[model samples]
Target: MSLPVLTHCPYCSLQCGMTVAARAEDDGGGWEVEGANFPTNRGGLCEKGRSSAELLAHPDRLTTPLVRDSRREPFREATWDEALDRVATALRDTQQRYGADAAGLFGGGGMTNEKAYQAGKFVRVALRSASIDYNGRFCMSSAAAAATKAFGVDRGMPFPLADIARADTVLLVGSNPGDTMPPAMRWFAAGRERGATHLVVDPRYTASAAAADVHLQPVPGTDLALANGLLHLAIKHRLVDTAYVAERTTGWDAVRRAMRQYWPDRVERITGVPVRVMERAVRLLAESRATMILSGRGAEQHAHGSDTALAWINLALALGLPGRPYSGWATMTGQGNGQGGREHGQKADQLPGYRMLADPAARAHVAAVWGVDPDELPRPGVSAYEMLDRLGTDGGVRALMVMASNVVVSAPRADHVRERLGALDLLVVSDLFLSETAALADVVLPCTQWAEEEGTMTNVEGRVLRRRRAVEAPDGVRSDLDVLADLAGRLGRGQYFSADPQTVFDELRRASAGGKADYAGISWARIEAERGVFWPCPDEDHPGTPRMFRGAGEGAERSSTRGYFATPDGRARFHVVHHREPAETPDGEYPYRLTTGRSRAHYQSGTQTRRTKALLDAEPEPVVEIHPDLAARLGVADGADVLLRSRRGRARMRARLASTIRADTVFAPFHWAGEQTINALTNPALDPASRMPEFKVCAVDITAAPAGEDTTA
Candidate 1:
């Protein structure tokens, strides 16, 4: 037997380290998983991580490519050459018929940095298409936008996860790490044991909230007001760090004036949190010597997520948090490679190294590396939702190539996304499983799974970890790199892509050098030797940056002082924002507010996790969590079937009555597909700044299912 290969989990951004040992031919051709003593998880793994290897041997795992003659026909097994030729020909023909913008490329956050970089380059150079975007736009775009506007850089967590354990207090806003990222809870547990206090702010008393020293359950979509209220109290109580604000930040006067309207009583009326609770929450953060403020999708999936995040950042600035040890603002990225995916080029408006596509210097630098003319590179395209919305319309995206994403089950207002996808002339998807989106494709390319692939992923803490291939993939299956190379070769652009991960990664390093997310110093060998390496490691002798903004002045190793910001003036800017109602709200027709989130056992779309027997058994199906009072009023009992009707669509699932959620709201997980797809009822109204759909808040009404009705539908 061979020794286990060290790797990271293929789940959330936690990227918990694990070792996978391949089984013998007689014992089943998969792998066994065990935890590794990495900094993030510290030898601990979540349920999804432990059972992730099961996907390698899943019976339904796609091992061969599937293709169809037309949209009216069923899929049939096809040769690799046939599939590649078909895809290339469709893309070329689409571009010839329509413009280059008509051939769109959609990527996933789960893709490694190497694949993401190559994919972006392939679309721009090979297809010469400007319409490219990924699912990360839906994950943390608002936080990313806010961070760039404030700090001029957009690393998800400016400080390492270890800082959480060293803080005196942590104010978790709109996040439930206990369920989404179980291994992350250990940091908070250690902090609590060391006399640190945790304050959770969420409408539902989530698992993270239940363990907090104080839980501020506010009304949904009012987090911005709540944050302003906290800042107002901190200022009134004489807790403002005047020196820090005056020296390190700009635009505080405008913010101070804006906080006047969010007094405790007015904030209480808006957020539904008691004035006393808001005051206590503010004091806990202000009095602490060091505090860390963290937020997740709950604060970033609304119509005003950018403003909401800015409000939180303003509160942190008021308490003098940024640039201090164990004190700063961060966002918990949800996907496995979300941090790196956006930084590289999967985003619509970015080139390699987190550089803007519209910048001439950035385009020239990357174009030189790719050996392409700077003028040949296309301009930035529409965002994820906008690109999806334009599909099949006149002069819109006619052909789409999807990589590693299940948009039908994951995108907001998925019913409309499904319709738009159906209207496409050509739909191509590459995935390990036949997801709901793949089921509607003209061609489905089977790709290698995590254990059977070698690549790199950046974690939530900005640490880039390596994933090594532990088991041989099934015969006839190919890596996404191989697929891309084959398609490029078919399109007469073979020199740009390589099937080898190391070669691709070396090229990615060269492409990312001297840019915001510089990784020229990091390599596979260094990662294997050091466990992981953070970015901004610009040279061979330079040490990796674990914490950002560490330096006190100019010319320092990691400067946080004035004149260091990426802005024109080199100072952090603050935005003054006020609360606004969500795009959709409860009304007479749809009287209950509906919110969606992830469950502990299942990841997004449930494509891979649903195939695992152990994970499926844990959370077999979707259920709408409703407050007991609302359930009683609707004449529904626990486990009773209910039909949730929104203005967009309807979903049928079992009711789970609980007091943890608010009486006027309902919660449902967005992992299932078909009639149980909760995203079908979600609001797709995009945030003006981030273009993120409001998945957290929508209006819906619930009614008990009729007798003999199929609740699963």
Candidate 2:
């Protein structure tokens, strides 16, 4: 029997390094999975990661292409040739009938970096679709927007993950590393031990809150108020770094004066955080030796996400956190390669080389690369939510091709999104299973699962790694890139296409030109030679970058420091927002505020984890987490079957009483679909500025279990 090979865990952004010690397959094949820490994950995998083998080897994984003849018709198994011809024919027909803008393509961040890179190119060159966005839009768009506005370039962190350990203080707002990336918790833990204060700001009390010296439980959607409160304290206490403000930034006076309009007591009236707690948080942050203000989906998932992030940056600048040792904006991205995916120009408003579509220079560079007339490239399209709203409307956005996403579960105001998607004349899905979105597609093309393919992926903190193949793919399953290439060939765009993933990857790298996102220094060959290197490695002589900018190595300069803050008014805008209820506040009908998030045992939406027997056994059905007080009021005991009803929809599940959730709110993991899926009851109202749906907060009503229903005593 051949020995098992070591590898990394596939679930979550931490990308916890692991060794999948290979053993000879009983079926006479070689495959393996075990844990080996690869620096990022520190040699650990969550429950979902350990059971990934089940998901990879699941018997039901799609192995063949299936295409539907007409609307409402069942998909019939078809040969690969037939599938490609149909796709090509559709593309041509749609372009001829409605122009390029009529059709749209949405990319996925979960795909390997190579697949994601190629998919962006294929969409523009082969299909000529101007309306395209990625699932990453829903996760980190706010932070990305803020970073680009501040740095003139977008980077996840100016420093690296390991740098957090040296920080004297860590200010985390709307981020929970303990549950999502447990290993990342080491940074906070190390900071706490070094006499550093840990301040947690969230509406919900999380594991992160438990460890923090102070937990500022502001009301939901009040991050701006909380942030402004901090800036107010900093200025009031003379903690404002005048040197940093004068030399490194602009627009301070307007923001400072505006902040003066709202003090802690006034801000406390709007945000739920007490005035004293807000002051303490501000004092703790300002007094620390080195402080880092970290951000994540919590702050970014709102409509005002960009403003919220900018507010954080403003506070950082006012307090001199920017460009310091371990002080600056640290956004914890949720998806693997979410940062990389955006860098590759899959965004509707962007082009290759991290250039905006609207920029003449950026447009020309990309146009030159693709060998197309600038006019032939359509103007930028709307955001993902707007795309859904415009689905099947006057602009001819009637056809949608979803690659590696389950929009039905992920999109907000899911019912409206479903209606919008239903308007599509053609809905094509390329994925591993008959996903919830796949169920809506006219064509469901089976694609390769993670372990069945070889590619590269970039994690949350900007570390690039290789996705090594461990097993043979099931019967007819193919990689998403291969599917795209095949369709491109049939569509007469074969000149730019190739089946070898390495070739596709090379083209993607060439598109980057080795500058901002230089992968020119990275290659499959280099990865095989060494373990794997961080990107922006520009040349062959250069070794891969492990951590983000503190310079690379000897003679490398520290990521240029000047204490530049990333806010428009130079000062962090303290949104003195009043206490407004949630998007769908619990009315007379629904009494509980429904908060959704990940569970310790499963990944998002359960699309991958539900297939694992061990994972399923660990936590089978969906369960609602309610505070003990709320549970007592409702006469619902732990494990009691309960129904959850919201203004939009309803779901039923077992109730698990706990003190973790606030009394007014209940928690649900958004992994399940059908009856227990949290999306069924989630409100899809988006943040006005960020266009992010209110996945974090949706009010609902809960009820006791009907008699005879299973309620484990």
Candidate 3:
């Protein structure tokens, strides 16, 4: 019998540990997977993780390069060299015809750390293009922006997941770990054992809300109001930690003045969360010495997402929650490597190591690592949605390369995005399958899957874990690294790029040496020995920092004068914020608020999960979740088809009677494509601070499907 290779799951930020071994010839020809003991998952694997191996040998697995000369033509099998040459020629032509920014690269949060780093380097160095951004902008950019402004740094969860078990109370705002990341729920279960209560604030009674001690169902896009109300009550009830706020934070007075307007009554009127429920939430938070406030995409995917997140952070700061053991304000990162993806320059405005692209020093440091002049690096590019909107337009991206993202299905206002993509001069996509976005590509390069490649990924808690190769990739398929190297060679920049994962990671360490997300101390060997390592580890002997801004060294004694924050003056900032309406509000024509989220059985865009038989069987199609009262008003029956119309586009989905949802709102999972894709109806209003689109709420109208309307579209 072959020994099992220890590795992590390929889906979500949990990155649960698992083992894979080749099945005996007599048993089967594929690999068998089993959960392995790990701190994040604690030997638990979700349904998606368990069935991930199914993708390895699935029929949809792309094993060869495909290409076409025009959008109207069908894809034809081509050699790797032919495909690389075509992409290289197109990129060069686009840049030469227009400007360097004419070619854009769209990346995914699911990519490995090495691939993410390479993608950034490839665009800035080889193509010399400033047009590069990733899908992570849609995931948690608002939380990242808000946290960086208030706390000097953003590390998803500043503390470890185990800390949740030790907390006296956990306030989850706009996060649903129960369905999004099930393995991490064990920590909550552990907290329950210790009598720690959970408070969930969401528009719907989600799976996580069902398990919580309190559920605050506020109006969509009103998370800012709800958080402000809690802080107002905390101050009104004399529960503010005055000493901590006075000593450890700055700009609180302005925030305090701002909160004055958010009295319980006004907040209740704005958010539709009863005044009593607001008071109960405040009491629970104030009474607990150890409390955690965590936000997620539901809170951050808005036109004012940064302010919404800042409000939650202000509430936590007012209550003295951050920088303490078993307590802090954090955001739940959604994608598998969303935390690392942005840190390593996949983000539009960031250089490697979370450094600002506009900073000359950051540009110089990264340029030195790449053996290039600092001036050679291009300035920051546009955000993801803006880039997509500008495709093929004059003075915009004429050619686009997509890696691991299905933008046609995932981007907000996707139907328009599809049209823009169709207008592109050249579209190149690298993936494991022909996703909805890839189906329109002019060239498609087959890349290795997670279990078939070895690399690193930063998990939800910012711990970097290793993904080991369990089996060889099928013939004719190649890793993204190899494809990038070949393309760079074709572009006459091969010497600057390496196809090996370890070499790329070592280079990443050097480039990130002194930046905010320092990984100088983390070596591949050390990661293998320690299972995983948190970031900001500065030296070889230093233990990876599991927590941040706590006087540097582990458990080091600190003086009162030294504040515990990453801000310039060592004190966390408090931004004065106010609640605002979503970009699109429910109106007489569109009388319902539409919100979108994830399905327990599927991951982003449903590219890989939809191909797996087990997951597809579990969540066969997207469904519109509506309150029974609203369904009855619309004369819609459970399991009956419903036509949902929005200003952008329309989609048809089954009407599911969910009493847990608000009557004024409807919910849909954005895991499928075609007319069933809820993103088609989502608004693309961008946050000024984070450039994140408002995917959480939009105006929509619903009615029973007209007779003979095809649900298949």
Candidate 4:
């Protein structure tokens, strides 16, 4: 028997490096996954990670291309050639009839590096449509924008998990990396379980919070205020890393003057965090021998998201966090290679290698890399919300082709966005399941799953790992890369593009070279030999960076080799914000705040997990987590049924009386659909800066489920 191939987990971003055993199938295909050693996960597997085998071969795997006659009609299968012809015919004909802006493409960072690169190429060259975007809008686009504005770079770490292991403290904000990024957790418990302080500030007491030295439960939508208050205490206590601020960064004085407005004493009203808690938070970080302030989606999903990140990053700056071994504000990007994807222009306003699509110099550089004229790259487009908002209107998009994203169940203003999408001339979703996005498609093309295909995935930590092919996709399904390439050729262009993922990947590496996040150094050959490599690999001789910028020892003036915070403000920002009620507050009619999140048994929307009988059985029915206090007030008990409604719509589900949330809020996982779905009540109000719908905060009213429903066993 052949030994297991070394591969990365297809699960979340901890990107656990695993060794998978495999055997050839009668048809010359194979399957693989961790039944062996992995640095991060050891000999363990989460339900989602281990279920990759089942998920890869599900009965429902889309093996053929399909198209519908209209929005309400059922899809009928068609030949790939016929499907590609139709898509291309529509694309080209629409381009000629409506202009480049008439058609749009939405990409996803979840795709392999090759797929992402080729997807962009397909749109920018093959389709020639000016409108293009990806799910990064919800993931980390704001962090990318804000980090680039400050440090000229934003990634999990210039260093590795070991660095966090070596640090004396890690201040986790708006993140649950311990749960989401399990490998990162190795460092979470690194501090003698006590030597270093671990602080988690989130509205919900997430899995990561269970391990923290202190869990600060601030109200939802008030992170910026808490951040500012901490910075206020840092400055007032004279913990400012003055030397590091002046030399490494640019905008400190203005920031300091601004922070002065948020003194801990004054922020209590706006943030709902007491001054005492804010003061303690300051002292903990300020006094630590080493510290790293980690930021995540919670901080970036607010209307003042950019400002909130600045506040958190600014706090790190005040404490002289950047450029140090332990101290820096690193935004935790969730998708595999999400960091690399943005660096390669997967974002709406960027070019390859962290270059700005709007900057002439950067655009020109990328144009040269792609061998296309600068004009061919098109102008910067709108954010995801704008694209969806403008669908079907004058000068708006006529078609939207989505790759691997489930928008109908996921996107904010969930109801309205779907309504607008239903009006489009064409909606094509390429995926493995009948996702909400695919459900609304005029064409749903089944694509290969990770195990059934080979490519690379960049983890949350910036580690570029190989995704060696393990199994053959079920018959009838094709790789998305092949689908797009086939479509491109049938449309009268892109004849040179190959259906081979490796060939597509080579082009991606070429396109990714020479920018701020150069990956020119990486070759499939190198990754195969080394297993993985952290990016910024600019040459063949270089070993990848494991940990990022390091700082000087305690009580030492910052040494030159440590990384520096290069904020234009020279200091971190302090945004003192007042608590504004959520977009849709519960009224006498709607009485509970509805919040959505992941279930331990599933990941985003359960697209993969639900396919696994083990996991599906584990969570067969959807239930809403209601605070016991609230449950009592509503005259409901455990296992009772409830009807939840909002201004937008409503859903019915079994009520779970639990203390998992604040008494004022309820928890619903976004995995289930139909009546049990919680998104129906969610408010789609987006963060003004990030344009992220507030998935964390919303208002809904709950009443007992009607008589026929099982309110009791």
Candidate 5:
């Protein structure tokens, strides 16, 4: 009998380890899944991870390339040669007719490091186009920008996940791992078991908040003010670490001045949290021996997302938490490869190794690795939202290639995005399933699923994990690497592209050798042997860095002497920020604020999970969670249809009356398509610094559907 193949779950940033074995039957059957005892999940699996195998043999899984001969024609099966030739010809024609920037590429955060690297390289080197970006721009770009500004480097977590259990107190801001990443809730449970206090700050009483010792229900998009208020109270009570601040930080005076205006009373009024409750929460964190501050999409998906994250980082700096053991500030990345995707050049302004594309030295280094002239690389293009907004417009991208993303269901103002997609001269999508986005493509290339691909993924902890292939891909399905190689060959850049994952990874290591997200010394064998390896592994003899910012202070070992930070002066910067209202605020026409988020059974856009029978059965359809008080006022009963309308668009879903959410707020799961998609009503206001859209908070109005109306239609 063949042994079970060890691999990581292909969902979420947790990258929970799992084992899969092929069944011995006369027919080619599906593989069996079992939990593998790895550090991130500790042998535990969530519903998404447990049922991930079902997607491999799903009925809707794409098995052949599809092509449309004309804009008005329906899609028909085509050979790989025909599809590749058509895609290559369209991209070439678009570039020749308009400019290099006329051709665009859109990638996804769920792609492996190798695939992402290849996709980025293919766009810049083969197509010679700067119009390249990925869905991660919408996922964690604000947090990444804020972290880079404050810490000089952006890593999802500077410490290990185990540190959560050792902390004396944890302040979770705008994150609910219970509903998003179920397996991660065990760390909080362990922390609670260790007598640690957990404080949750969110507009709604989420599952994590319900389990917390103190829940501070603040207004949506007021996270910055609430954080500043906590800092104000911490200063008022003289709970700050004065010496540590003086030694380890810069720009303290600005932060102090900025936080002074956020007094307890004013903050309470703005955040909708009582002053007493704020004080208690502040005291719990300030009095603890070690405190950790963690923020997520809720705090980083607004117009002021970067500033909001900076406020939280300022609080951590004031408390002397960063660089301290078991205490720090980190963003919880939502996508499986969100950390790695940004590191390996999928972002518009980034080169491999997280290097800035604007830097000549960085450009030269990467250009040398790709065997191209430094000037040959195209300049940085617009961000994700801007790229999508420019599709088919004059002086904009005329051709677009999407891989592993369901932008139709995930993009803000999704209806408008769909219209823009329709206007594109050419649209090519690669996926294992014909998602809403893929269905609109002029050509669809069938690609291998996660279980049939071997590559590495850097998780939220900055740990690089290996995902080994456990089963054979369906006949006629190809890996993204193969597609990229074929496309590169058609574009006359065949020598630079390789169909082998290891070859791409080798080049990625060289490209990323000395940059911020260095992976020069890591290998697949090392990852398998070590379960996973933390990055910054510069040499073969050097062990991976488990915890960052260590060995820079007293009582630390001398072997790892990389200092306390990656900043020029080895000190963290503190940004001074003030709170602002969301891009869209409630008014008479739109008296309620709408928020969109994930559910436990489905991930972003439900491209893969929705095809799994068990997962579909679990979360059969989308619904709007409305507070009972507001539901009563609107005549919306439990399980009744509610018409949610915003200035952008409207969606209809069943109402789920609950007291957990704020009376003025309505929550919807963004996992469905058509009229059920909450993104249809979301605002596309972008953050100035990060260009991240405000998908978290938007103004909307909800009304009960007319009696006997078919809302689901």
Candidate 6:
């Protein structure tokens, strides 16, 4: 019998380590997943991870390339050469006729570091297009902006996931680890065993909130006010770490003055949370020896997400939580490789190494490695939503190439994005299945799945890991790296692209050297020997950094006071932020607030999870979650069909009478397509700083659907 292959889960940022092994022929001839001892999960995995092996040989797995001359025509099976040639011809024709920026590239946060890096290079060096972005713009961009503004550098969790167990108090802002990263809940349990205070702030009483020592149920989009109110109480009760603030941070005085207007009573009026609850939260944070605060997509997927995240960071800074052994502020990255995907480029404004594309030094360094002149690289492009919103318009992208992401069911304003896609001159998609977006593509390329590819992915802690291939891909399928290399050769940029994972990663390390998210010291051999290595490791002799922002003499990356932070002066900056209502709020016409999120049974867009029989059985379809009081008021019964309408569009879903949700708000899971897509009713208002769409809050009204109305449309 062959030994089991070691790898990480393909869903979520936790990336739990697991092993896949083939069963004996006498038994069922299938593969099974078993949890492995890893730092993040500690030999534990969720239902998704356990059933992930089903995707390896699913019946719907794409095995051949598909192409069609027009959207109205049916897809025809084609050879790799024909498909690549067709895609290249469309990209070339679009660029030649409409200009370089007319051909755009859209990527995903779930892609491996090598794939993400190559995509960034392909768009710049091959297509020479200034229109490229990824779905991560909708996920972690807000937390990234906030962290960069506060700490000068952004890693999902600057310390590590295991640090949660060491903290004496944990405050979670809109983070639901119980339903999301179920394995990580062990740390919360461990902390509780030691008398740690667990506090949660959310609009819904989620699984994580239910287990918390205190749950602050605030109104939707009032996170900024809730954070500021906690700070107000901290200052009023003399809980501020004055000495630490004076020594390690700047701009606190301005922030302190800004909090004068955020008194407990005023915050209660805005957030619907009581003043006593706010005071208790502040006291718990102050009294604990070590405190940690973490935010999630619920907190970062709003129009004011950046400031809301910054306000939480300000509270942590005021309490002197960062840089401590077991205390700090961090964001829970959602996608499988969200941390590394953005770090190694494939983002709108960033080059490899987390360097801004507009930075001349970065451009020169990357250009030299890529064998191109700095001038050949295109300028920074528009963001994800803007790129989608401008498709086929004048001065906008005429052709788009998508990789790893299913944007049709996931993007904000689902109906509008679908329309823009339909208007494109050419649409190309590379995925393992015909996702909602792929169905509209002019060419659909079958790509290798996780178990059939070998690459690297960075986890939530910024540690880089190896994903080893366990099984052979179908005869007709190819790895994404191979596809990129072939496509680049067809585009006359053959010398710059490599199909080998190691080669691509080596180039990435060189391009990322001397930059913020440095990987110069990390090697594949080292990763195997050490399980995984953290980033900012500058040289072979340097130990990879797991914790950052220490004082002088700690390490090279963690240098003296003058270099404590990544900013110009090395001091952490405090953002003086104020609360603002969401871009769209409930009113007389639309009297209920709408929020969307993931269901534990499925991942993003339901691309893979929905295809798995076990998971599909767990959650058969999308449903609208409403409080019992709200359902009663609307004369809706449990399991009743309801239609929700927003300014953008409408969706029909089943009503779930859940008391865990607020009476004034309704929730929906955005993991379906067609009429059940919750994003169809979502607002696309972008955050000024992060450009994040207001997916967490919008105004909507719901009514019972007419009898026998087709909700599946």
- Cα lDDT, all candidates: 0.90, 0.73, 0.91, 0.71, 0.90, 0.91
The whole-model C-alpha lDDT of candidate 6 against the native structure comes to 0.91
TM-score of 1: 0.98
For model 5, the stretches where C-alpha displacement exceeds 4 angstroms are 26-28, 551-563, 707-713
Q: List the residue pairs that clash in candidate 1.
A: 551-558
- Per-candidate clashes come to 1, 20, 0, 33, 0, 0
Decide which is better by TM-score, 2 or 3.
3
Q: Mark the regions of model 1 whose C-alpha exceeds 4 Å error after superposition.
A: 24-29, 553-557, 560-564, 708-713
lDDT of 5 by residue, 25-50 (tens): 75566677888999998899999999
Q: Is candidate 1 or candidate 4 better by TM-score?
A: 1
Residue-wise C-alpha lDDT for candidate 6, range 398-502, written one tens digit per residue = 999999999899899989999999999999999999999999999999999888899999999999999999989989999888988898999999889999999
State the lDDT at 256 in candidate 3.
88
Taking all chains together, each candidate's TM-score versus the true structure is 0.98, 0.91, 0.98, 0.91, 0.98, 0.99
Candidate 2 deviant stretches above 4 angstroms: 25-30, 70-73, 514-516, 525-532, 535-592, 705-713
Question: Listing every candidate in turn, what is its Cα RMSD in Å to the true structure after a full C-alpha superposition?
Answer: 1.7, 3.7, 1.6, 3.8, 1.6, 1.3
lDDT, candidate 3, 1-713, per-residue tens: 47899998989998899998888888877887888998898789999999988987989889999998777788999998899999999899989999999998999999999999999999999999999999999998999999999988888898888899999999999999999999899999999999999999999898999999999999999999899999999999999999989878999999988888988889999999999998988999988979999999999999999999999999999998887778889999999998998899988888889899999999999999999999999999999999999999998899999999999999999899999999999999999999999999999999999989999999999898899998999999999988888899999999999999999999999999888888988999999999999887766787877877565453742212246876778898999999888999988999999999998999999999999999989989888999999999999999999999999989999989999999999999999888798899999999999999999999999989987786435
What is the Cα-based lDDT of residue 504 in candidate 6?
96
Instruction: Report the candidate with higher TM-score, 2 versus 5.
Output: 5
